[model samples]
Target: MSHSVASPSPKLSSWTHTIGASLEPWINLTRVSRFAGTMLVFWPYAWSLTMTARSANLPVARFFYLLFCGFIGASLSHSAGCVWNDILDRDFDRQVERTKGRPIAAGKISVPSAVAFLWAHLGIMLWMVRDVNSLAFKIALVTMFPLAGLYPLMKRITYWPQAWLGISMNAGVLMAWAFITGSIPASAFVLMGGTWAWTIWYDTIYACQDKKDDVKAGVKSTALLFGNSIKLVLALFASLMMSALVVVGRLNGHDLPYFLLSVVGGSIYLAVQLYAVDTDSPKSCWAAFHRNGFNLGALIWAGFLADYIWAAQGPALVDFARGVAVGW
Candidate 1:
């Protein structure tokens, strides 16, 4: 008699499934662990807010206050966006392996429930931004509906849904500037363009994971549009993204840290990711997309933060640096 070796994978998977199924349907519907995507929404807001704070010499207390508000706002909006996307794609999601188990697709949550949840996020977001400048409030409203709301539909009719996402995701760049400054600047629009290009860069990689499924499901994406030349097109977008950021730095008069970390380091990291990702492999594509949200985002935000702090307390930082250089 021989004892067959039972691999641990199935047991581990069963345990994971059990834990997953135990969660409340609403939480699962939100994909609460998609923090990466949520943070992507927050970063543009933070970066632009800091830039405006530095330029306007706004009080540090207020800056932090706005930053906190921005974080809360981003989380809510991203959740709402996810709910909206899921609602519109529930049928298509059922046909895709990666999305088939999603709450709506799996019959764990009804479309009505999902829509109600989406409304909940939107209502909270509206309340949070109630005191914002009217212009900023309108922009925020636009982002929630005509922009993010239209994103899922874009995939049905166009190959450039990523382009729409780029616009929607980075619209916060303008909203932050408007909220704090009461006006948008040419430089902020330039920054929006850069982040827009970046959204396409990362999302096309993300889309690559579902290329085959998307084709059969009649979905459109940049990954399928670029086809054999996907990498080439992505590289072009990468170049456009970096170039726009550099231009915005020039326009905004950002500190050397912005140039070094956000521009130089950012470009290097992007090149590495683009080179290392095997778009043909779903795992590789997902890894690259995740890294963009985590690592790449950090680089850009660090530089913006450094510039903002230096502007806010330049003389103090210089004095502190001098003391450290002389060993106190």
Candidate 2:
């Protein structure tokens, strides 16, 4: 009886390997190590929520809840967009030294498997935003098609794929505004414009990493389009972004501190990045791109958070001061 033990079935082993292989590529394709990109995508949404909550006196708990939702939505949507991009650009990725190791390009995943993964991500994203306000939900629906569906094709048709990306990526500013205010505003568009300019600036830097391969592969991008004038283009976009920031701050009645930290500080950081970036060096381009996540993104959010805290607490502090004065 003890000698009657049986070996594992070959069919079971084959099925196990198939399941693991199917899921493994998803982790690589999502580029989870590049967490910076996800946070950068999430920041505009968080900023809108914080600013709107401050101005509207919305409950702090509600603001946090919505911000968390934006984080999850942004991450899922960004991952889906990446998978779609990889699927569309598999051939192009194989030609680029930097992207040649990508899951789809390396043939670690089949296109059908990738498509399935993409739909799964989109399905979860939809579920996450389902409880949001109607305006936000509608905007999310409309924008998802363009960002996740059309963005991968833009690179084939236009040198301004970065511009398309700008429009798509920053649409979150509007969605977040609608989520909180139940309607979008003129100011939200202004902020969106600023966010668009910022996208062009940083994405151009990101594109620089693949400029040589992109050109060889006939892939058009702002990095290739701008060429020797790339720095000038970055400067112009950075200025536009800063101007938009100033306008949005004024529209929202943000205090001097907000302008100083978000607008001024962010400008200085961008300037340093521009100065330090070597457009010809892929390493420099990658560094500059990642820097945008923390330097500009965190600075802007810090200003908004500080402003919100002060606005919520300032009256109490003033009242205490007045009471002390009267007692004295």
Candidate 3:
């Protein structure tokens, strides 16, 4: 619809080709340069881990180890998902203005190349989780297939592909809880639901950026479906997301920090997002999407981390502080 019809990508500039072109396609294929998407994937794991670790009375050292592992797992899952999505959507991407030059879409790499790259990520993911509990390992494997693997095709048939993504993208909540606790209690599902709504809200804002190009390219998204009422619909989802967080906080008996920062701060942040983002402008939409990954996400995670750290190690920390004062 924009520029040339779907075709092989042209060569990079002379110096770029000689310098980084060899690895550029692989790099672009996984979107490693774009950290926001990876952060989106990691936040769910962080929120879930810190919240659950408090209840488990996990040691500080062990909690951090698990948190680090969650980040690596999130990176692998997100990178793999991006490769698979690119492989499936290359044809559709070539016609979309915003995505035409993506590695697979622009034909910088073959589908087989992308597929192989995908397996490399998955192989690493499997190895990374080999020591995790059996249930956690199985749950992680399940996310690899239909949950995430089938996502790109959802746009071909449904206007609410973001709904599918809401579930797939935040699945780390379940996997991480299972990894740490060997079980997914009702609260895990409750928190996952909140993260799911959160994904839908932000991703719909993201979809707004491509509304025109997507229509021309015959792609369906909530942006097109919600049309003039996109703001209202997103607001509703945001409210639901905030409500779920509050509900999860109650069920888990989270301290004041969580109720104040995660629930209150998160709601205020969403209100700012609602008031600020203009879906009609691509730059505005992209900025709002970035805030979901960086700003709003951090507030929520910080609340959980603060509560967990205080609850799990507050006494020990106080004693150490007293010892240091005496030594001084």
Candidate 4:
């Protein structure tokens, strides 16, 4: 008996191509494939969850579950925000070299389609957080309007659009804090401020990538606002962020490792990024901006995780490790 291989049907191939073509623009609009922004949005939520879990003595399994949900919520919401920004800024985007090829700017996707896509993501985000605390839900609802509605317009009217973006991005910190504690605490506000400052620092670097384009397009940004003082302004923000982190750790009673990793380590990582950044070079600015997600964010999360483990497991583990070291 002879066996023959069957070829793919033309109908199936056509269907696949059509689906891919339709989905590509939506994906590009959302920037879902580029995870730096998503991770940046998620980190503060993760930090809040870990801190709250430690304070509330929540079960480790429950902490992990909430963390997973936070990640999903952050990613979805960030993508939705990106779509909204693109929809509103399509005209300005077309005028900017860096953004000219964006889905809406390039005419690969229409405004109405992008709006529909935005709502779809927003719907999913609402569903994901439906079971969270009422306060978290309410805060999330309020955040969506300003972030998705107002952030895009900031660039048109203010040089501090990065500040608006910072506020938009760091809203998750408040949401996550409320989700875990059922109320926003003073420490949460402090963390929010810290996150806001950090956003200003990194996003200023990011905005530097399009400063010339922004000038030509009549757009405003902190990058152009700071101009020669950009590095000084970034340093100030970074210092403020580090100081706020220290205050947060003290407020939450995080141990020495928390300070070591999240404060000192994160500052060192940020310092390296700052030292290497060249405001005039788009490549340097982009690299420094993206590096914040992995470097500072990871260090802070690691500190929180370490503190959580030590708190949950007690001093017996620490003593046992010390005893082992002595024996060795």
lDDT tens readout by residue for model 3, 156-262: 99999999998889888998779878999888999999999999898999999999889988888999999999999999999999999999988998988888889
Clashing pairs in 2: none
Worst 10 residues of 1 by lDDT: 23-32
Q: How many clashes in each candidate?
A: 0, 0, 0, 0
The worst-scoring run of ten residues by lDDT in candidate 3 lies at 6-15
Model 1: per-residue Cα lDDT over 189-229, one tens digit each: 99999899999999999999999999999999999999999
lDDT (C-alpha, whole model) for all candidates:
0.90, 0.87, 0.89, 0.88
Best by TM-score: 4
What is the per-residue lDDT of model 2 for residues 1-328, given as tens digits with 9 covering 90 to 100?
3667688899999999999887776777997778878877888887888888888898888888888888888888789889989999999999999999999899888899889988999899888778888898888988889665898899999999989988888888988778877987777899989999999999999999998789899999999999999999999999999999899998999886688888889899889988999999999898888888766798988888888887888789889999999999
> What residue runs in model 2 are displaced by over 4 Å at the alpha carbon?
1-24, 320-328
Best by lDDT, which number?
1
Q: What TM-score does structure 3 among the candidates reach?
A: 0.90
* Residue 291 CA displacement from its true place in model 4, Å: 0.9
Compute each candidate's TM-score over C-alphas: 0.91, 0.90, 0.90, 0.93
TM-score of 2: 0.90
lDDT of 4 by residue, 1-328 (tens): 9999999999999999999998888888778888889899999889888888888898999999888888888888889888888887889999988899999999998788888878888888878878888898888888888665798888889999888888878887888778877888888899989999999999889899998889999899999999899889999999999999999999989998799999989999888888889999998888887888766798899999999998988688979999999999
